[model samples]
Target: MAKDDMDKQPDSVSSVLKVFGILQALGEEREHGITELSQRVMMSKSTVYRFLQTMKSLGYVSQEGESEKYALTMKLFELGAKALQNVDLIRSADIQMRELSRQTRETIHLGALEEDSIVYIHKIDSLYNLRMYSRIGRRNPLYSTAIGKVLLAWRDRHEAEEILSHVVFTPSTARTLTSKEALLSALDKVHSQGFGEDNEEQEEGLRCIAVPVFDRFGVVIAGLSLSFPTIRFSEEGKSGYVKMLHEAARRISEQMGYHSYPF
Candidate 1:
């Protein structure tokens, strides 16, 4: 690495720590002026002012009128709520997911959208020796998996596209949708049907079906999926799996405090 890059690394980390320190100080009270915040965080007044301005622009902090006092905004609470929701969601989803595994004897997954990708947060191994190989914390492309499709399908069309606008569509199999337009079209079908499919898209000879798990506010929070091999695939089986997944997802969503489960 260049000398400039090496020298800048520590500065970047220090900046982050300083920003958090200022936020902590601001959060300790209703509001504080730049001078008071600087004293609390042990930073220069100009430095505190700069960070506050940046946070204000990002909606995490708000300046009171034309005054120098700045207060932390509700944006931080909104982010914290999302984190807490996911924790509750995973704990409650386990019971339903295990039941689905027992019924189908197939690999089951619970995934959620993370950035431009779908991240596997929970999984149940198949009873059979042949099963889809996956584990928690693994990330897969949003354009090539059943869970990914369901995650994007429930969103507004334009918002979904914008989420994936910067992502490079790399095909993992011949069946993988390799463009935003193609994926968008499939998303329409998935949205209408209340489920999504991966027919040898992420990997050859592997098929998966998934349905959405909604939060109490009726927002799609996660996806529940069943995976099996082509050799075991059947039209009737697929339909049954879809029904089973929807049922399991409904129960999981209810456990997370959502009484209404669409499809």
Candidate 2:
């Protein structure tokens, strides 16, 4: 009986994988009708419709206007936001982020690793005329931004290589690091210096400095960053900004019950 149950587990797991694949396909295509979704998932139309109906009932999927096309519902965002709020790092760092912005008069952001991307969970916008614009819930490439680099730099070498394998280094600007080796070297510097810099790598004319926020186990849980316009701060000024950013991140990590490091 135990052997039979073990053997049946693979079929159950495969069913879950298939459902996840269907959801991924729908997400990639943004919106797809039943026929297209069936073809995309390599499942029959009846099977796809049944699974989609189940998902729709669970609030994970929704139909479009009078059409049979399916799209992800806002329920995912609601769940995700609740999860983020419960994260100790985000809760601990919220006050530090506000303080960082108050002191520097620049935008401060908090991000965490989400699969192959970085998800922004909290932000304090700058009160300036030419501040950068980034939504709180957006995801950005991990290899192209300061906050992403700080999180990546905390990973082991082998894990970093594995994560970088999925990253395509499309140059957002001329200063963007395009080569894997270059990114690796930059990560090394970030690890050594306890901070990272985005010199218009993600956006033109904007500069950002970031530091990792570690958990009680010394593992990176999130990243804190401050962003400003390049025209406002020279290289020396940016370096000073990095110093302040690292200090703020250290305070946040301490508030999160991480006390082992002497930061």
Candidate 3:
């Protein structure tokens, strides 16, 4: 809504605005006292204090002592760092993904785990006339995609199981894993081999291979994959393509502050 419309908003919305205003004012300096902050944000001292107390309890704000000033905590900084890392990851992955496209002439995709699916964040189209049909922002089933399998495989066994528990396990193709047990078995292989594959599981006659991209904390935050048609796939070329993907993913992960590449 417009700024003028916001003025006519309900009390809840006004309170939210006041809270954010106070936060913005506090962010301008290292610390702020209740009265000083209230004046800056045009809020009452008691109201500001109430919000500060609530924020402090929530770990968004902190106070040194009962008499000291309120200050913004590291939580906001942590959240911002995560967002920045994702942006940098995509930027770095773009170059590597493009390189892979040139080398193999296949569709390249970078996917991140969302609530219960893998969302494509970036992609490079194949040079050939026959190519995988996919788009950025498309959500693919985690149980049937190479990227999704890699994402799940990198997590703890129990955690991976818990995540799959929420999946409905709808088989998109005849080859798709239709049970949690089967998916878990595939994940075991993915973990052991340090890569994942979709052999006509998501779509008939399509195959995909993916490797994990790690973050600064060495956690798999994304999956990078190459897609191909069965006609274009070769048993001997599988290992070569996997090596290329691993190299690309390693470089991208290193750029994202992860130095130890698993493969």
Best by TM-score: 1
Scored against the true structure, residue 81 in model 2 reaches a CA lDDT of: 70
Candidate 3 ranges with C-alpha deviation above 4 Å: 1-5, 9-19, 29-73
The TM-score that candidate 1 achieves is 0.88
Q: If scored against the real structure, what TM-score would every candidate get? A: 0.88, 0.68, 0.78
lDDT of 3 by residue, 95-182 (tens): 9999999999999999999888999999999999998889999999999999999999989999988888878999988999999899
Number of the top-ranking candidate, with lDDT as the measure? 3
Put down candidate 2 lDDT per residue, 128-200, tens digits, no spaces.
8777889888999888899899888989989989888878888988998898889998898888887888888
What TM-score does candidate 3 reach? 0.78
Global lDDT of each candidate: 0.89, 0.83, 0.91
Off by over 4 Å in 2: 1-86
Q: Which ten contiguous residues of candidate 1 have the minimum total lDDT? A: 1-10
RMSD of each: 4.4, 13.0, 3.8
